[model samples]
Target: MCSHYEAPENERLLAGFGVAPDSKLPIDLWPTHMGPFIRLRHEEAREDDLPELEALTGQFGLLPFWAKDRKLGRQTYNCRSETASTKPSFKSAWKKGQKCIIPVSAFFEPDWRSGKAIPTRITRTDGGVMAIAGLWEKWKDPDGQIVHSYTMLTINADSHPFMSAFHKPNDEKRSIVILPNGLIKDWLNSSVEQTTSFMQPYPADRLKVENRPG
Candidate 1:
């Protein structure tokens, strides 16, 4: 449910969205952190900002290997929950709590046709922001530069009466991780039981998703 989230270089920006830099973006990699992570897309990756990247100090992470190497994302960007239980790509985070919440203004999902992609906006019922579920990991390069990368989680959408209208992939094959505001913490805690309970839909009718001009 996320793709665009910003914590503004200033700490104040987070308070409005209910995130704190010490806890979330500019990303503090502390093991005891909570809250959502804003994935920096390929276009958002500002290599010139090494200082901001260095300032992060590993507060949070993504798939250590995949994010470090772009080649991995050809298959790594979105992990299917149906196969997650067995897919080698996501087995580790599934069993463990190396997870992160992906917060966003709106998530971009495509309605695929012959070859073109039609993008839509799926946001909270109240036109507010949201957090998508994610998994994080950290790895080091040959020269010792640490890279923290992550992948967004997905779930089937047939259950979502509104989302299904968009023909979002259901079948438990590929769905994005979305939770009500209250459950964010429980998922972050990520105990074997907590994660299991989180997988269920959050009462679909309560949320609203409308299609915008493509």
Candidate 2:
């Protein structure tokens, strides 16, 4: 599961992904922290009108509107694609179509080849930004304050050539859903069944990794 990531900062990179250059967002993000997300805002749009994509920052972990406390968000930072539509933490967002896209420059994982974990940064081969699929929720705190949060969606990676190498030796490998530029809109608008098709490992040839020394 993705716990840390770099947010896009270059104007050209943001433009390439259809993100507004003026959109406010943090440059780095970690689980349970604030991060940027792109989604169609429909506060006033007609049912037949298409809402424009907007950038907004929210807590990385999703907090269901019915949640009693924000602390639960920490454990919900990553939602498994296989159970997102059925899991208690993410099911409501999935059913309510609270889809979103997280613009990331890179994400970190641990490589255990040396019999210990080494933090490794993974990026696109072309060094462009990647769009990670996610779910969002709006929750009202006890103070009546509304807070928006989100969670990254992940899929099984045990069969993937590259993704399978991460995590512990015996643990099931998992990979985030990195959406291609052409599929961003669909991810934000597609029905639950149709959206399932987007959950897959990114091509290994299009990715590169850099290991951080201990």
Candidate 3:
């Protein structure tokens, strides 16, 4: 599961995702930290018309409608694709087709092969931004405040050539879904039944990783 990632800069967001956010975002984002995501401008637009995408700054973790507080996002930053449609914290968004794309410059994972945890930064080999698949939601607090949040969707990567190398040997390997540039629009407009088709692991050949020590 992914717990941290590097958000794309404003220029990269505009150039890569074609949407410019109104405010500057933190470069490094952890669960509950503010980050940017792209979703359809109109949730209820007709299928015949092409959808317009919009970028918004939202909490890195997803907040379900029933969540009591924003702190709940800390535990929900990543949602498993296998159980997303049934899990309480993610089912509503999944079922409602609240799909989104998380634009990240890179994401960090732990490498445990050397008997120690080394922070590894994963990014596109071409030096482009990664369009990570995600889900977004809106929550209303008791004071009538609306909070926008999102969660990265992950799939089992136990047999994946590269991603399987991360995490502990005893733990199930997983990876966040990275959509190709051509599928960005299709992903945001996909129905619940069509989402599984886009949850596969990205090709290892197109990715590169390096130790990102602090």
The best candidate in terms of lDDT: 3
For candidate 3, list the clashing residue pairs, or say none.
none
Winner on TM-score between 2 and 3 is 3
Query: Candidate 3 residues 138-200, lDDT tens each?
Result: 999889999999999999999999899899989999999999989989998888899999998
Residue 56 shift from truth in candidate 3, angstroms: 0.8
What is candidate 3's local distance difference test score?
0.91
In model 2, residue pairs whose N, Cα or C atoms come closer than 3 Å (at least 3 residues apart or on different chains), thus clashing, are none
For 1-214, candidate 2 gives per-residue lDDT tens digits of: 8888988874744576545535556777887777777787785753656446777778888998767888887889899988888999999999888899888889999988678988799999998889999998888989998888989999999999888888899999999999887888888878877878888778888888866445
lDDT of 2: 0.83
Error of 2 at 35 (Å): 0.7
Q: Write the per-residue lDDT of candidate 1 for residues 1-214, one digit (tens) a residue.
A: 3232332332433543333345434422122222245423232555654221111223222343534443454455566666665777677767766666655555555555324446655566775456667776566656777755566677777656555544434423235667777766666655755665676654555565466544
lDDT preference between candidates 2 and 3, better one:
3
Model 1 scores a C-alpha lDDT of 0.52
Estimated TM-score for each candidate: 0.65, 0.90, 0.94
Give per-residue lDDT, candidate 3, residue 211.
65
Candidate 2 weakest lDDT stretch, 10 residues: 12-21
Model 2 lDDT, residue 119, Cα: 79
